[model samples]
Target: MHESPITGNGDVVKARQAVRVLAQEARLSLVDQTKLVTAASELARNTLSYGGGGTMRASIVTRGTSTGVKVVFSDQGPGIPDLDLALTDGWSSGRGMGLGLSGARRLADEFTLDSAPGKGTTVSVLKWAR
Candidate 1:
């Protein structure tokens, strides 16, 4: 796994680039690469703006004959109090339209989220090669 710090908007861009590289290395199609990159951008921005910055871990994952990329974003900031509400479309705790999490989930083949009021949050998403 490779970890990159997400301290600001610039770091979010870096995260997107990093994911793009990994997706390319995994032999993902251009469309799949774009999807993963876009999802990474959104999640990284959320990590910085909402979670007060965090770390993004990218890794290559293989399952049988399938290979994919997995990214996990973690932060120590104030966690989502109501995950259900937070996951709702158009719900925003800050200035965004609240589409980051839901949108990322929609782009990835698999998505998982873990958060607590004071314990912080971690979101993991995966995109498989076609």
Candidate 2:
């Protein structure tokens, strides 16, 4: 499967379009498409809000025994000083309920976060076909 990279405003319509393209090409079910796209939205928002602008790298890959759609978000923001606290629901820095990453984690089948105080942040989420 091929991959597409998106950046900038992380517009809702564009993000969903990217997801639809993958799901269509991969022959993923409608249910999976909805969840995956929702997860994408969360990732995109974080990029826009905290990172002051970030990049969204998406691809379909086969890893080991699992094949799925993966979206990676990276940003050069102030960096999350408190990952633990940041992930908490309703615990936001300023204009968030603090549920972005946490919600994304719950929706995705596989989630990983890499962040530091000043070095920036990277997040990856994969949703495998069921």
Which one wins on TM-score? 1
| Model 1: per-residue Cα lDDT over 58-118, one tens digit each | 9999999999999999999899999988888998888677899999999999999999998
Per-residue lDDT of model 2, residues 36-98, tens digit only: 888888777787778776667778877687667888888888889888887888877755567
Q: Pairing residues by index, what is the TM-score of model 1?
A: 0.97
Worst lDDT 10-window in candidate 2 = 1-10
Give the Cα RMSD of candidate 2: 2.2
TM per prediction: 0.97, 0.86
Per-residue error at 110 for model 1, in Å?
A: 0.3
How well does model 2 score by local distance difference test? 0.77
Global Cα lDDT for candidate 1: 0.92
RMSD of each: 0.7, 2.2
